[model samples]
Target: MRLQGKLAIVTAAASGMGRAGVERFVREGAQVAAIDIDPAALKALAAEFEGVHTIAADLATEQGALDSIDQGVAALGGADILWAHAGMPGPASVEDLDMTAYRKAIDLNITSAALGAGRVAPHMRKRGGGSIIFTSSISGLVGSMMSPIYSAAKFGVVGLGKSLALALAADGIRVNVVCPGLADTPMKLGFTGRSGDPAEAAANEAKVVGAVPMGRLVKPGEVADAALWLASDEASFVTGVALPVDGGFTAR
Candidate 1:
């Protein structure tokens, strides 16, 4: 029970890394507030988990991130950890990008993560110390030929984590970011726009997998494990890291 007695709030909790974090944190004995825009999935999580509280809200705006944390603090008594992660891939090319859509997508990927962590910092500080983890991407660690804007947003997340780590060190709040490669998640399917076509989806996934040295996609649980470690007392001395759970994609 590494996180026993801890209270945590995770964004994007309906699926992907968010859902996995909820499951893992609860299993390790943390009370959690699961926030997402998907009401149905959040409802299901609340119904299944004894200590989970669900909040359906978009994390793409400053107000949205703040509102979720406010409700979360009220529900969980206080928060000891924050997995301040909720984002989606934006346009694949610079030419295809709609500036309006770009702003919204970047808000979700970078702005919300930074705002959410900032809002939660004080609450964690009040508890003496707490962990704050952001979900970035391997694209954040390196340039992406296919998604330059999206890569920029992910890179911003890493910068947020590093800066916060230093700013909150004296408050005993540790900040870190997790950079994941292609994972078997809805985001990947949506990125390819082939979620409905099994054959096409498989082909796309295969291509994504082939680029990874591991020959497979990273699992949600694996990324969750990394976040869990950073959130636990086991990582009391660790912070400001852009840890990659990317099957060694960045190494290449």
Candidate 2:
């Protein structure tokens, strides 16, 4: 119950790590406003979580980001925790990448984070304090051959978190990023494009596991747990850290 009585906002919360965070936060007694672009999934989530507030909005624009936060505030009185976790994978290589795809990646992964932080920091400052968590990735810290645009965008998120941490500390707001390794999610499945071949995809995915010293892919819930800790009073003294929930992948 580390987050008991807290008000949290989780972006891209229809599925994957974002969904997991929303679920965990609610279970820990937090009032959560879950934002997602997928209307159907958002509806399902709202139905599942009796007290949860779900906002179906596209966060790639400044207005969208502002509206989402405004809705969250309206629902929960104020936001105690902000999980800016919306993102999408771009092209696999520089050669194959298009400008449109690159821009989309930046919009979803970096710009959205910047806007979300900007919106939440003010409310948190007014309240005297708050926690902000960005969903970064191993790709942010290291090179990823799988998606160059995604890596670049994630790197921007890490940078945004660090800069915001320093700037907002005086306002009693803490900002940090969590870098998750390969995890099983719809996003990952979409990245691999191997929906029809489980065996082949599993073998290809094993390559990532082999690279990790822990010899496994991190679970979505596991990353959610780390996010919960960062958003709680347990991490009161922590800020500006790019924590790797990567199962030793980054260590190697």
Candidate 3:
């Protein structure tokens, strides 16, 4: 019951770490507003959690991000936590320089978090304090040969988290980033471009696992556990940290 009676807004909440976070927050007694681009998945999430509010919106735009937060806050009556977890894999590499994909990486991964934080902060201030969590990647800390665009966007997220943590401290708002390494989620397949070839997928996974000192993929729930701590009162004195749930992947 770490988050009992709390109100939260989670983006990309239909699957992976976002879904796990929503489930954990609710189980700990929080009423949540789950936001996702997938309407059907949002519906399923609403069904799974009787009291959860679900919003389907594309978060890559300023209006979309702001509107979702406004609507979520209205639905929940107030907000204590905003986990801006929506993100997408950018182009496979930077050699081609796909401007479309590059812009998308910046928008969906970083800009949306900024907009969401701006919109949610006022609501949080009204409630005395709040937590703002962003999802970055280990790529944020280090360069990624696979996708430099994704790396740039994720790095921006880490910077945003630190900057906002300092900017919002006076309002009792804690801003932090969660940098996940090679987790067992759909995004893992996304990183490898899950084609029909099973061998190719397995090979890619093995390569990624080989880089992790733990020699295994981090679980989605494990990332959620880290985020849950940030969202709760236990982290009251914590802020501006880019926590890595990377299973020692970053250690190397």
> Which numbered prediction scores highest in lDDT against the true structure?
3
Worst 10 residues of 1 by lDDT: 189-198
Could you tell me how far off, in angstroms, the CA of residue 242 lies in candidate 3 after the best superposition? 0.6
Once fitted onto the true fold, the runs of candidate 1 whose alpha carbons sit more than 4 angstroms away are 194-201
Clashing pairs in 1: none
What digit string (tens of lDDT, one per residue) describes model 2 on residues 179-236?
9998888877645653558776677687888999988888999999999999999999
lDDT of 1 by residue, 1-252 (tens): 999999999999989888999999999999999999999998888888876999999888778888999999899989899998798878767785688879988999988887888788888888898999999999899997656888999999999899999999999999999999888887887565534787876787787788899889999989999999999999999999999998888887
C-alpha lDDT of residue 223 in model 2: 90
Q: How accurate locally, in lDDT, is each candidate?
A: 0.89, 0.89, 0.93
Candidate of highest TM-score: 3
For each candidate, what TM-score against the reference?
A: 0.95, 0.95, 0.97
Better of 1 and 3 by TM-score: 3
Q: List the residue pairs that clash in candidate 3.
A: none
lDDT of 3: 0.93
